[model samples]
Target chain A: MRWVDLVKVEARIAPLKAARPGDGRGSQSARVSVTETGGQLSRSSTGGVARLVAGGVWTIATADRLEPSIDEAVNTLRGTVEIDLGSIVQIDTAGAWLITRLERELSARGVSVSLVSASENARRLLEALAPAERDVPPPPETIGVVQELLEAVGRTMVRSWEDLKSGLGILGGVVRGLSIGLRHPRRMRFTSIIFHMEQTGLRAVPIIALMSFLIGAIIAQQSAYQLAYFGADIFVVDLVGILVLRELGVLLTAIMVAGRSGSAFTAEIGSMKMREEIDALSVIGLDPLHVLILPRLIALILVLPLLTFIADVCALAGGGMMSWAYLGLPPDTFITRLRDAVALNTLFVGLIKAPFMALIIGIVAAAEGLRVAGSAESLGTHTTSSVVKSIFMVIVVDGIFAMYFAAVRY
Target chain B: MRGAGKNPEEVIRGRGITVGFGDRLILDNLDIDVYRGEILGVVGASGTGKSVLLRTILGLQPMRAGEVEVLGVPYSDAAPAARSAVDRRLGVLFQHGALFSSLTVLQNVQVPMREHLRLSPRLMDELARLKIELVGLAPDAADKMPSELSGGMIKRAGLARALALDPDIVFLDEPTSGLDPIGAADFDALIETLRDTLGLTVFMVTHDLDSLYTACDRIAVLGDRRVLIEGTMGDMMAFNHPWVQQYFRGTRARRLGA
Candidate 1:
């Protein structure tokens, strides 16, 4: 046996040893030799007739050792071969499958194989496994590496096209729902909107506030250290003020919300789709976009800006505290510097991106959820991609806004 | 009910089983026995602990108080080796066809063989294919994941995995619950054929009256927290209990001319 086989034997015996520590039969070396000697096959050839004698346990546990000899016998033996099973003490499906496969292989090679002195139980097992002789189709072939790469690239391109179409479709449906709701305010699901606001906005306050605060303080300390080299440590207040209000606050908040509420939306709607609840609603003449997707979208759009405003305030407060402690800049001086560095448009630039980010997250999540098939695994996959696609789109939209602001010199 | 004494032919013997959740007792001092080479059907009303009994016997559920001996070994309290020895001889098919979602039907059937025995992958594949065919699944189903299968195919694949080890006793929970009438009958016939060829002792929990009539050799009715009656289909018809009377001779049973 190879080293790997020895390791496998040790792993197999370890559990048996732990299970029965003091039992005499549980001796590891003793059991290995016993298994080897339990099953025996001897072939004697006279002229063109080969008599193959088999004995002892022929179950699955001993099949690994017995299979090679059987294969060799099938390859070398020609003419008529008689397999004697008279001394076989035990057998199972695995053992029977082996014997049946051997007989079939020999017969296919035009060697007449006959079974003699077999017990009734062995015959029954062999008959039960005889249907396995029917040809089974081979597993699907895999493409070569270059072709596989091309296939993947094509699949991803088609998938992204489908995604873009669905995103536009959902946006149009939401717009239609908004128009109908505007015409008849009473038709809007205000209670559902409120419930979702509490779930996605109100419950997320503490974590979002804490995250913004930590990020603000880290930026303050790092900038102060760099500015202290030039004896301009007070400029850390301006860096913290502009960066937090213009970019980090809303971007971080959108990323967090994408991970949190965006994935939740996909999971909830995907499970409903999996169970055919969406179909049930359609059959009942209720639009899923109007009832399900509309409330979530509106709640996200309304709450994201409010959350962004709160995140900005918390981040500014954290920067103020960090400037005071780390740079010895008093709170009053830090406030004056922040006021001088940022104007009204600075905060609005960040808040303006909030609703657009929310829209992207909602549309992607709802689209993925609606695409779910009837499996828990599919629901999980869609939920994962909802978060991933929304986060990626959020960053991409932020980059577009950045480039637009820089070009127009805002 | 039959006496609770041990019998040599009994493959599974449970005595004085008591199982419960919280303050509610589900099974109270229940005694059950499964004989070798017999298709024993266990039936009861919904939430009457029929599945709970099956789980308890399989050692998946913890019984409040009981002792179960499988293959003449005390399964519940045996040494780990002895318990695993008993476990290797038993197979269980859960309701909902709980094949591992990530594995193909072939790999699902190979799981037990991989864990317990040292066999080549080629032989394992052939044996798994044999089992899949034995359970009446199409040959091509070997490569399909559990998600790709329909309701009936899932049950058949689950049965194939259960029979992977060539177990002596097979436990089935609601084996034919979701299939159409023709599909359910086909599954029942498949179970009967497997039991005949493999000499498998089937312990099936079912609600399908046709299956109980056509496939089972003996029927056990669980009611009032214990087996109310156990015998042939004729014995179930002659039993005096109201629930048993309505169940075996109900409108659906009447459609089958019971």
Candidate 2:
């Protein structure tokens, strides 16, 4: 063999050597030999074939030369040893037909022939070497109970504290990134802030307005039924105003933006991370945290307040319309009551929460995006996580505000 | 394809470059040089510090024990502004296209110019379109998202983006590994044309032998923790290095040569 060929063979057979039995069964193992001769085999070459049988099983490596003698040998021995025809470097179709015939003859007598593992041309020739009714051993069946059990436990473990740890790591990255932005306000341009607000906040107006209007109308209509029973339907005006301003207005708007732009932030940045465009920015001596994260955070911060304020206006308008229809209360009276019932603190609480919620959404989304490591699936998962986490954080923050406000009121 | 012979002044000179991930050294005392206006192809077995070298040169990776000079500026000598100034002279095409999905192909190509050059939007668009055309993409492709393109098309689009600023140097990591023979040959021809026309220096990391022979002015065979041999393909074949011989005489190499 050539030196390169010897290296290739040794590299391939290294694992097989480790599997060998150490009790000297190595002597019984099959051996491969290649010999060249000018003589064609009919009967005189039987001794040459004998010289090749140096071990338990012998394989003759030849190229279009020893077909006749090899054919005769196949006919002579049916079950004593495995015959490997797969390694033939070359063959004619007629030779392949003869090999197939020998394969069928031997298989009928309960012997197996070594096939495949040859060069493409030889493998094509050996394709029909298997008999039509030959019985091949079935593949070992897999015990899926262990796999299923392991998968179940694996999934359970993945969803537990480890997942939370990753989530917190992402959260920490967001906070760290945002803190840097705050320290270097120049990192976030005022123009990009305006642009982002126009895109994410101003563009989101119609949806938020429509949603708040429907919610207010629904609340007014529901309260009208209960108030009418007590001959006090006018109270629906007070109910709708207080409920929307105190809770639904800020909460629902944040949730909507969380689902909408928050997830967008996550997906946009996540895809950027996946594609290494973020790395490209760093390589170009631009801080990706500043260029990407800052503008987004600023935009979200500026937009959330305006969106919340619009949602508040629309909800009150819808409630005013419904109150006029059912409660016979004048628009001016309802407006006055809304102005009085929603204390300055309540309005301040909502407005104050807006920037914090924006920061939360922006950080959560960008953090999730940054955490994306692999395929598109990770992006989807992170987007979902960003929305869920931002909304949850928003609600929790709002709840804290509510408690503080209640304590001050009482 | 050989440039007017000069002293081969090094455009990038890396000395004893060492990179580590935690405790494991990915690259150990690796020294390399990329010459001006030369196409250097780096080949190695998998995970043999090929990409680490590329990153270290770009300053994206911090070398634990080494110094590197790119275009006469030490990689870490500059702060942000100076670093960006040095960076403006270079471009990178990663394995994936890494295009900004929200931006159009034209916009993706225009990013470097937008950041560094004070060019007009109309002018940037014109230049970006020119680059896109130069990379053999259709004019209509200039507006499409990255998702709309095929794998080979994405690589070409990435090439267009890398050429956006008309940088003097370019780095392509595995530019043709996934392409069919015809596609790969087309890519090689494109690189050759760019090298001749633009006088750009290229550092290409690849195992594709056809690319090494057809495009690289010199090949750097990376092994044994550093470059084992750096020479022309003919020189590489003549050399008695076992890895080089094995690589040049491989079955796939023979088929590629044929």
Candidate 3:
């Protein structure tokens, strides 16, 4: 046997050795040689029949030593070969596979092979191997990188188009739901809308207040340091007032709500979709769009503008406090300068975008949640993508609003 | 058949094994033995520490008292080399298959072989294929992920992994739980065949009455924090425990008898 084959045989024997209860069988196994020193293979011609004899133990422990000889012996045979296993004492899966493989090789060469005097265990194992050996799979084909890249691009385009079509469908559902609610206001699930308002809007007060406050203070402090060189510290109040009222307050607050409420919406609805609770709702004749999505959308639209107003006041107060602390400007004069530098149009500009931003976040999150599949992994993926896509679109809409308000001179 | 008392070498022996979670004692000074080359079916009602017994014997649960011996070697707190030697000879199939969802069937079968053997890649492929075929899975199913398979195929794939190293004793936790009647019967047949061909000592924890009736060589009933009785199906049929009477001759058991 080859040196590597010897090492492999010894490795398999180690587990069998440790598995046996006592050490007495260890010595018995050591004396059982796996090589051709005791094993024998004989071929004889009798009455125009080719008979091949297999003798001694045929097991995994002896497989490596016997494999090459078995392969060589089977190749030298012709049609109508009889494999006589009357003298073979033991056989394992590896030994059985080799015998079956030799039979397969013979069949490919148009030499019919037959077995005689085989053990029952060998016959049963060989029967199990027959179907697998017959139905061999072809090797996989290697593709060029350009082909793979083109395939991926095609798949992505198809997915994006499907997403767009589904978005339009959701929009139609929302419009239809609103029209139905208008026709019968009392049947419009007012309680659910109120409940969601408290969850998404009223519950978000502290976080939105604190985040907008810190942002307002940071802007005032930085702009004050720069304006101090120009000896125009009082203008910090006007700068803070215009920036927070028109852009920063609503933009930052919408982003916060998208992360907080959008993710919550996706997780809650995605888990429902996963459990088929949405299916149950629809089966009971309650439109999922009306029962699940509509209330959430209306709640967000109402709550976001209210939240923007809170953020606006808290930010102005923070700016006034920072101006008082660092620039030594009193609150009375800060409001006085603020009134001169800004107008109601600036404040209304930020409030105007809040509802639309809320709509985008609410719709995107709800849509992503409904897209969840059967598995837990899919639910997680959709939830993460919902938060990411909502945040991205919120910023994108904010940028578009900035340009639109600039163009129309709002 | 070997008698109970005469040089009966138990491949697994548990003595006075007491395991408790908090104040609730699960197994109280339980003693059990699994003889070599026999399929011992452990049965019990739900929440009756049947799985706890299997886990404790496998050294997964820490016992407050008593010692456990597997393959004639004490496993708990033993020398690392001695414990590892015993581990190489034992295989466990947990409930639900617990297959790695990310790995394909072929890769899952290869994991144990890769850790245990130094065979060539070609030999490993051949061996894993044989194992897959042995477990009655189609050859093409080897490349499929666990999520892609049906419940029955998952259990078969798990059985293939358990047989990867040709372990001396295989522990199966509720192996037939999620399968339909036909599927569970086929699985029981597969277990019986494996034991016959491979000389395996199987310790199966099951609630399937059909398995206890047809597949097992002997049955052990666990209740009241210990093994209540262990013997042949005839012995179980004649045993006098009230829980055993209710369990072995219940409406479901009578229907299974039909």
Q: Top lDDT: which candidate number?
A: 1
Candidate 3 chain A has its poorest 10 consecutive residues by lDDT at A18-27
Model 3 lDDT, residue B142, Cα: 92
Clashes of each: 0, 0, 0
How well does each candidate reproduce the native contacts, as fnat?
0.22, 0.00, 0.05
Task: Estimate, for each residue in A197-238, the C-alpha lDDT of model 1 and write its tens digit.
Answer: 999999999999999988888899889889999999888988
In model 3, residue pairs whose N, Cα or C atoms come closer than 3 Å (at least 3 residues apart or on different chains), thus clashing, are none
DockQ per candidate, 2 decimals: 0.29, 0.02, 0.23
Worst 10 residues of 1 chain B by lDDT: B1-10
| lDDT by residue for model 2 (B31-136), tens | 8888766788999888888988898889888878889887667765556655666686688999877777667787889887667544444335545666787788
TM-score of each: 0.91, 0.45, 0.78
| Model 3: per-residue Cα lDDT over A202-278, one tens digit each | 99999999988888898999999999999988889889999999999999999899999999999999889967899
In terms of TM-score, the best-performing candidate is 1
Task: List where candidate 3 sits over 4 angstroms from the true fold.
Answer: A1-131, A134-136, A174-207, A271-303, A306-310, A374-377, B1-8, B16-23, B52-90, B114-121
- Tens digits of per-residue lDDT for model 2, A210-255: 9999999889989999989998786787788778877789899999
Sequence-dependent TM-score of model 3 = 0.78
CA lDDT of A12 in candidate 1?
Answer: 22
